[model samples]
Target: MMRHLDPTRLPTLHLSRGLVVAGLLGGVATASGIALTTTSGWLIVRADEQPQIMLLLTAIVAVRTFGLARPVFRYWERLRSHDVALRDLAERRTGTYAALVPLTPARLGARGRTDVLTGVVDDLTDVVEASVRVTVPAIAALVAGVGAAALTALVDPRVGLVLAAMLLATAVVAILADRLESRSQAAVLAARAEVARVVQLTTEQADELRVIGGTGSAHDWLRAAHVRLRASVARQSRGRSLSAAAVLVITGASTLACAALASTSGADAPVRALLVLAPVATGEALGVLTDATRALARARACARRLVELLGRTPAVVDHPEVEPPSRRPRGAWDPLRRTAHAERGTQGHPLRPHGTPRLELRDLAAGWLPGRTDLGPLDLTIEPGERVAITGPNGSGKSTLLAVLARHLDPTAGRYTVDDTDVTHAPLADVRRLVAVVDDEPHVLAGTLRANLALAAPDADDQVLVDSLRRAGLGTWLDGLEHGLDSRLGTGGLGISGGERTRLAIARAIASARPVVLLDEPVAHLDHPTAEVVIADLLQGAGERSVIMVTHHHVGLDRMDRVVTMQEGVPSHGQERVPG
Candidate 1:
């Protein structure tokens, strides 16, 4: 589904027509430069021959015309290239985001999922930047190089051949530089990502690190990361530096050869002088090839990484044979006795439309890795409005179970169904839309409270938002706010406490229209009292929806309809580990 696997497929391919125009404009700019230099040389040398002033006037005019046209054409080229590049960037970002929507929280990476997503954002930017930084430059260089060779050859064949050879040598040097830099690009990228991760962790956890006396360990990590980054960058730069030197050497040789040929030729003094200077002008024009080389290498590396991540097959795909019933099953236990009453609505929804949402997992064993089941070959059913809490020790697959339920992970061996129909192979998007996940570390985005809350329910009014916040245990806090819902939060704004953050996530889940709400240790980061308050408020409004919460600690278990604790090393599926 992705074109980047070919290694040659670039985002710029879509902007071919625009890029071609930019390249042609660049060629004109470069050819004008060669013409200006050649004509200026002709005018100066011919005037020294004591020819009539009118004889030099034509050459002078040509020089002035070329000089003026160079800047005009160059400016137009820049405008066209940048416009196309930015447009391509927008499209690529949009497409990439759409592709990632289905892979979130699962394929993104198990730990530090946010960091993995952030890295992808940066990597995607780099891939698009290649259009402006790498591909456009390469196209312009090719166009300019050819224009110069053609112009010089038209004036004198021998100097033209020398110009062509110099351009060829420049191309060879650029290729060598690209190879040298490409080898270090991946290392440099990895080192940079690591360094970024360390800095993010150290800065965010400064207080915790200091309290645990792990500040020194964090500093050591930073130092090691910095060292590796420096080494990789230095190695990467070697190619560009070498290419620059080679271009200079080639320039000198070609210029000298042109001069020798010019002096021996029987051409007029004006023409001979122009030929001698053409090769020097051509060399100057091609000097920027080194930068182009570096950008190309960097872009290729970024594209390869992005393709590797985004091009993989999604974990869950829809079952083509089983279509979600046209409508929700009409009130069969609302969703309980779903043997009948399922009716197709005007809107197409997942199969088994009807009643209250029923999620059933039978012998559903799944894990992050193959051949290693972290969860059930067990059975469980969450009926409509059922409040279930799954508690277990670490590595007992609490989060793994939640992930599978949310359709983020596929079950390895069992049946997961909604409303009596197996939905293990259901459309991931449809399944996920029915579930809202509230995880441990909740993010308060850098926006107004209204903006953050509205993300979950865009069509919700202010009253609904205030109610949601109140229901999530932030009622008193909301009433106290001067700006109320308009108040800003997150970085560069008002900072919220841990309890507030957890409540905010709860409020968001409450606001979402999803029928199934999965909480993965929603209160794990909160203190005991705050946890109780949040739990009380979280369950208050979830009367009509199925809520499944996974936690290691038994917090507010009495309020839940059922509490199931997963056990480690149960030795077989369907056996709930009971402590002796």
Candidate 2:
């Protein structure tokens, strides 16, 4: 179980430190209280008709010291423990989000709804609460209880034996109850997850449900899920209450047993012993049992959920021995190195002329999923100073082919060469530096406009950004905005139109100044004239740079050096190229 759950993977270092501090403080407070209670009990017992004031003074001093220390220590312990719990929850939440980044839409879609939300939020919070609120306190109580029992035993074996037996019974009961509770808790969590999934699915398909007139069916499904969840929660609550009640009963019985044992010892034995030992032992035992049971249940639940999340393997794995290709000087090597090399000598080609194609795809077969092939095992080449238009019907795999060239998805079979280097084996970062892709829906972060543009090229100056925006036909739009470059844009503020957002995305891609630029439907939302102007600007602005554009519009098709049409997942060409 520990191997599967791997608690070490949890981001709990700071939380652990706080819990340790709280535990230590609690231990000190508990030890002091037990020592005071014992000392006071023994003194009152020894006091006879000729009682000395000094004895009373000593007892009073011990009691006063314990009273002063207990509350202060307990307060600090509670504060620190809660601090640890909250901080741990925050850290786990952050780590879960970070983990989701690399997994993308795939892993998230596979996970059950309740599992993702609860594991990242509720279950992680429970783990921290279990450690600090339950586990640490239980440990402190056990330490104090054991010490008190030993002291009592040394004074009177009968009293000590009674205390020890009662504690053992309580521990056994708690362990058994915890086992039962954990099973119920796991069921409750699973049920809750099912409910969440059903709710999420309903919300996501709200339009479909309305269109199909199946709202009533969706409501029935959600109601059933909620009923199951409530039933599970009720069972878990019953288990916890039952365990708590059993602990209380056993504690009361233990107190009675201690009192009876003390009575048989002697009439001379002090009543103060009963007062101190009975309450302290009972309280400590109950505290320990209650906390231990809660901790055990919560820990088990959290561990199981975390295990499910971290168990998944990444879809793509990098080869350990792969090395990045050396960066060539910008203007030194011909941009179309592969074409130049092919035209010259196939073997040991040297001194290729400039103005050659920068990127080439040789018999590249690619797909989004495993079995359904999108693009070809077909040959294609783009030379420097060339603008190629890739026009096709929707679902014709234009974006998929562009994605392969951008190295976003690996080809099912075939090779993509960049500057005569096989990009399939090259580091992703290296490939990204050579190619820039602008998508239809650009992700605008919650920040100033300047910050959003800076994401693509961090060091781009205001002038460069403005120039790129002007070239993309966004300069006049920016001029009318209140904040200009500093305008806030994202979910809540300074809403930009869809066409303007696309233009800004183009500006961002152009800011990178990479040799290869790929755009997917960049002008889809723009009017006819505006789109034509933007397309013309893009083709002209990208002079000496290889550009592959996926579009349905034919407004500027005459300007392109070549037009390739894809039909039924195969390229039907205007440019003469065959599968190599």
Which candidate leads in lDDT? 1
Residues 411-487, candidate 1: write the lDDT tens digits.
88888898775665454556766787899888788999999998886866777677778778788999888899989
Q: Candidate 2 residues 288-345, lDDT tens each?
A: 6665676668776776666566555543334455443444455554322233223323
Query: What would the C-alpha RMSD of candidate 1 be, to one decimal place?
Result: 5.8
- Record all residue pairs in model 2 with backbone atoms less than 3 Å apart, i.e. clashing: 336-356, 336-357, 357-383, 363-377, 364-376
Worst 10 residues of 1 by lDDT: 339-348
CA-RMSD of model 2: 8.7
lDDT of each: 0.76, 0.69
